[model samples]
Target: MSEAVTHSVPSASTSPGLLASLDPLLREWLPRQRWFAGKGRPVTGFSLVSATEVLPLNSGLGLLHLLVRAHQPLVPTQSAPAYPADCYQLLLGVRETLPPRLAPALIGHPTQGPLAGLTVYEALHDPRPADVLLEALRERAHLGELRFERDMAQEIRSDLVPRLVTAEQSNSSLVYGDTFILKLLRRIVPGINPDLELPLALARAGCARVPAPAGWILADLPADSLGPGQGDPGDPYVLGVLQPFLQGASDGWDLALREMAKGEDFSGAARALGRATAEVHTALARALPEVTMGRAQMEVLAEGMTERLTAAVQTVPSLLPYAPGLRSAFDALADLAGEGQTWTAQRIHGDLHLGQCLRSPSGSWSLIDFEGEPSKPLAERRLPQPTARDVAGMLRSFDYAAHSLRAEGTQVSAVSGWADACRAAYCSGYAEAGGRDPRTDPVLLRAYETDKAIYEVVYEARHRPDWLPVPMAAVRRLALPEPS
Candidate 1:
């Protein structure tokens, strides 16, 4: 069942004609994918950026590597201008008929197109195609405009078996032989991708709290395809990243829930996770340039937070009562900055939560997924931010775990106390690890935490109305004045 053999097929030319043929099928298929960002809008059409036939269709089983722009109608929002289209990296498998095993992966049989008579499905689900991808990465193959590169110092075995990770996620992943896991980003943008950039930086700094990338895949996109000022079109878009797999690791979220279920204290694990986070922060500071956010910068940051709150209150009217209280958090930060208060800023995991961590069988914690918030623009995600941003994210995650269990009908009256203890313990551990104590910077920490809660309120209100209460609870707590 392994299709690990390499083929010598000639690469296919990039053409709009090929995309014209697949347009109908793709329009029908794209919206249904979890990774497709334009979920509520209709796909107006598709424009091909690049296409390569990894394996020719004439070969009975074909694999096509495509980067297509999915055009969708704009939904106007008050805070930002709408983006008309999003680019996606697609690996399509073509066959005359699909086996029952791949039935779930089927996109559909194309009725009209170059693939008209064949059944087209997601290629990563087929091990043969997945194997081809890994082989390319191992060999550092250059097929058409796609570049498969690996660290010169690292050796990748070509025979590792590949299996698709079926988790409902924002991207696709393939685990190879329990040794390496490849994360393929579905939606793509120009410029340096932090998922690859951050890990490489951390590796150079000798930081063991994060996994180092072993290899990566990139695609050269056309200049016009990149939006205005994104970067030189010569900048390759990071499509996939391969890293060492933590074989026996347990997801931090799952581990926490288990401990809570048994009424056991999780403060110790939370504290260790905090220390690990501080270690990463310290390493990143040493490896990359850090900036000091002075009065001007802090004012701009506080202004952005205030604007976001204004927009969130408009969307979720339930936030109106707490709006004034929330406004105070941002205003206080701005007032302090007006008096010349300053803080350090550096690149951070823009969107951190318990779900982003893993605990090994031996109990060490490792952080993963540095891509930040998918909803944000690439430029914004890469900007330097205060370390408190990450600390606030982890603190909010503790509250989320407790509330999530309560939402599931767990009759635990001490849920709030459990969350509070973990939050305090985490900050204590962070200070012990030689990082500044977050508690001492109440103004900065409170501002970031309030900003995060506002984001969650808007997100939950739109996507999960029932779960809105989870963040709303935090809003209630955050809105109150800090105890002296």
Candidate 2:
């Protein structure tokens, strides 16, 4: 079973198209994937963008590099507009038979065509092919438009073995002997990927709160906005990014839980984390362009929040009682905008929460996953947003941690007091770190928190039904009448 399969390379001279044979397999497998965004909908069709063989087709093994477009129609609902087609990268390993070690990586068996009677599996799951991919990047190899480039200043050891990080969902990560990690993005959109763009900018600005890019993979595709009527055309889309792995780092969420279990005060750590966050924001603002939103634009932002709240109540009926209160928060924001208020906006972590951060053993915090809200368009994710949004997200995370303890029958008063102290210290640290105090602007912060809670309600209800109470409680708090 370990023997390599020998088959004619599918090229221009081949009879059946290589992509045509794999079409059915992809359509069947894509929707079943957890990383696939179109979970509730069926995949209607596919459009092959590119099919480049990383190695020669008839080499020791068959490795096909493919970028395919999956078409999924909107679910039958008036509020539901058609979701745009998404492009995904597939590194397919075709073998005559899979070894026991690779048995878990099986995609499916192709019954006919060029891949007839062969086992095709996701290559990243197999160390052999995964090493081959890393070698290609290390050697700066080029196959057609796909290029692998690395920072020459940073050393890349080819000897480091590749092992897949199994817990990832939206993307795949492989650690090379604990020295470096490569994050291969699954769903892709053309243009600059913020996951790569933001970190590079911050790293150059001397920001120590983010992992610097050691290497990356990119593909040049036809230029197009991926709109309804626009044809296929776009610039290079970042396929993956590599960075030095943080050794002995713990997930922020896990750290918080540990502290709660020990009954230890976490205000000190929370304050330091807040300072780190502000420093990164400062670096980003210095590196990127900053903008100011006028009253008109603020109103537009309020409308967007209202729309989200409206949709959320339809699914999470528990939100019905708090809808009016949440709507008032958005209204207050709009009223301020009408009074000729303006706010500064800049590049931020976009989606900031405890789970998205990592705390190292050295007592320092690093922010990861710069990719903004997954449901948003790529263009919107790149837009400058109010920094208050990030602050609000962290504040909500504090509440989530406390409520999780309460759900476990912990004393509500004790956990609530602890959360309140941490939240206040975090805000104080942000102000001391040369950032604006979130408390100074209650309207914007409250609105952002409401918007975030509304989103959480829908997400928790769908994914973790038991956790729905955590966000539902926030909705009620945010909806409460202000102190007169």
Candidate 3:
């Protein structure tokens, strides 16, 4: 979390209007927020897309729902390649005075706007607003274009207390009485959100490897005739999704770390997880469209990998030394394509890692977080890719676990043996579970793994400098002996 700093509250607007006090407050507060995508970039301007008072604004306590476009230009000039705008959802709670408990959630006090002298803060930080949001969904209430909906067959109790899930990074999740979990997407994008679409499809396919979807909240925006597929019903942007909360479940990342701490072998658990992953892949293949990409497509895929590597090298100069060898891995893929190699492309968990999975008390794995890479464009993430990409993600995760321990001042060589054992066991289990063994295609697997490592290099450099060695070590191994 960023250190708390005092900020000058925005001056209030002269007009007496709803949301009149928000512009200045958000300008100062949004950049400091963890969920804000444009953290390092300057927020040049803001445009209010929509604002509705879910709870009467005039009331002493207020709940205002806002959709604001944050305009962040790469260069503060008109000649730049169009301004990049990200629409964000803001749920604001207004009170006459800040309570002792809610002090941490304060955005700031507006001195001149409509909310002048009132304490304004993030509503999700308070249970009252969380409960209000859930109850509205239970009752299927509609406030303008924002629709709060739920599955009629699933009964939701209004009295169920809501508690925010704190471990999340990209999105916010709230658990209600341990029965249901609602995930609110802070960054809003137009079109179908795969997080919602994939789960619905998996449930319909009768896949038990995923938690059942209970309900969802969405925003139906006015049609943009200029947009592609303007008449499509999926024009509505998904705001949040509700699903059953796993009561006795532990995240796979934590489970692996715990096993490592005990010096116990995780091969058995890794094998089971591999099988579960295959099951979900098979179910997704049955539920969605599948296509075969020939040599030409494989070349395109290889080129994309090379492009990402080149981009990462520019950002993380440490990658410069290994760029050639990394490019050779991609070149290997292209060479295979030249030999007429073909692969299957289908809907996959674009971003799959240990943390994205959960292990139930029964020892079964449940996949979650189907939103894909939050930084990637939605259309690109939606495109079908090799299932091996998901396998590579998990494979890299094992390596990450090993390196994480080393970073924690517990340097040991034993983690390598454990990770290798888990990787082999996982591949064997995947083969047994009716999926092709990733090890069988070493070139493809290596290429994908290399790509994933390069991505991690850039990510670690930007986020955790201390963690850069984790991926840098992988980069060194990927590079060859270099004419020894």
Candidate 4:
């Protein structure tokens, strides 16, 4: 079984009535869904930018393309790295969206509000979506339940069968075994995917921080094969990949709570996770030896920031106060770039978040998923990124864990303290494992944190307007003072 999503409405040329259009599916329901970025606020309105229907499509398996314009600030971090929120399309479905459309945010119920009236649900737990999707992709799409279950925990040496947690993706579904998760792919790629590619290499080298390859399923995609004009109209993307399911696995955020909860701090785990991260990075680098990243990469980051800064300032005029200060910071970071390459770069996990990591039953940490995300194109996601890119992402994950606990309704002061401890623990671990002291150079940490936070702020504003303040909170977390 593949991780599939289902919903009451799907967008296609022959879609259902008002409740079936992409707009109605997520109209007043944006503020209620967990996956929905903005909850609590009634939607002003939403518009469909574009929607493509899945070919050879079936009824129960209604596949379509959809881009929505909702009333909220766009988030840069939670989204694709490029083209910050002018307009974007997210493959979505129904089952992922709660029936009531009114559910609590991770931490805030009344305050955080519901998924109703938000945007859309990307995936679902119901099997309907997954069943239909898999059938279609396998060219045998149908409406039926999978009667495959085993009593014991599985190592999942084969393909994954994650549940249809929701239906909202470009080519992915949420599948779960008794002890592993398998994200099934809908689209197929001719070459290999970096997500599964790097982790397997690391695992083969006996790396531990990452989840070892359980098994993988290969499919054909004559449609998306390389070169222009040589693709199939009816081809489903890569089918999917499978991995060991973690039982009650705590994420970086959850681990943060345990650390703070015991007052022992997560320093131990951070160090361990850091060492594991380092090893994984080292192994990955071996597979990608041509990392000649230099100022050229910095130029890309700077240019992207420049464009986003412009867009953000326009959408969230309140950002005006920090605009000049932000620009100055960008310049300072850019100044550090050297004409000659100073650091190695490689194709890495483009979309890394707290959700990407898990705490094992043995109290060890394991990472998952190399595919950055569905929103990003595979080519861009596989681009060589600075080691700092991964480092910054890890740092952000630490912060996200701590802060997300607060969002889960932890007392602000308490979660804040835990967050601090977790942050320290993670950094300490990274330093001990990475064998580098970035925190010592407060300026360096500040620059990196700002860049990360800028991304978070934009991403939250667009995805979770209510949570936008969370990233904004990092504004003060930076070592830099408000510019005069």
Instruction: Name the top lDDT candidate.
Output: 1
Candidate 2, 36-64: lDDT as tens digits: 87787777877776777765545546787
Shift in Å, residue 365, candidate 3: 0.9
Model 3 alpha-carbon drift over 4 Å, by segment: 1-20, 75-83, 224-234, 411-413, 481-484
Relative to the true structure, candidate 4 reaches a TM of 0.63
Ranking by TM-score: 1, 2, 3, 4
Can you list the residue pairs that collide in candidate 3? 12-112, 12-113, 13-113
Q: Which consecutive 10 residues in model 4 have the weakest lDDT in total? A: 105-114
Model 4 Cα shift for residue 478 (angstroms): 3.4
Candidates in order have lDDT scores of: 0.87, 0.83, 0.82, 0.53
Winner by TM-score: 1
Candidate 3 yields a Cα-based lDDT of 0.82
The 10 consecutive residues of candidate 2 with the worst lDDT sum are 1-10
Worst 10 residues of 3 by lDDT: 1-10
RMSD of 2: 4.4
Cα-lDDT of candidate 4 = 0.53
CA shift of 96, model 4, Å: 24
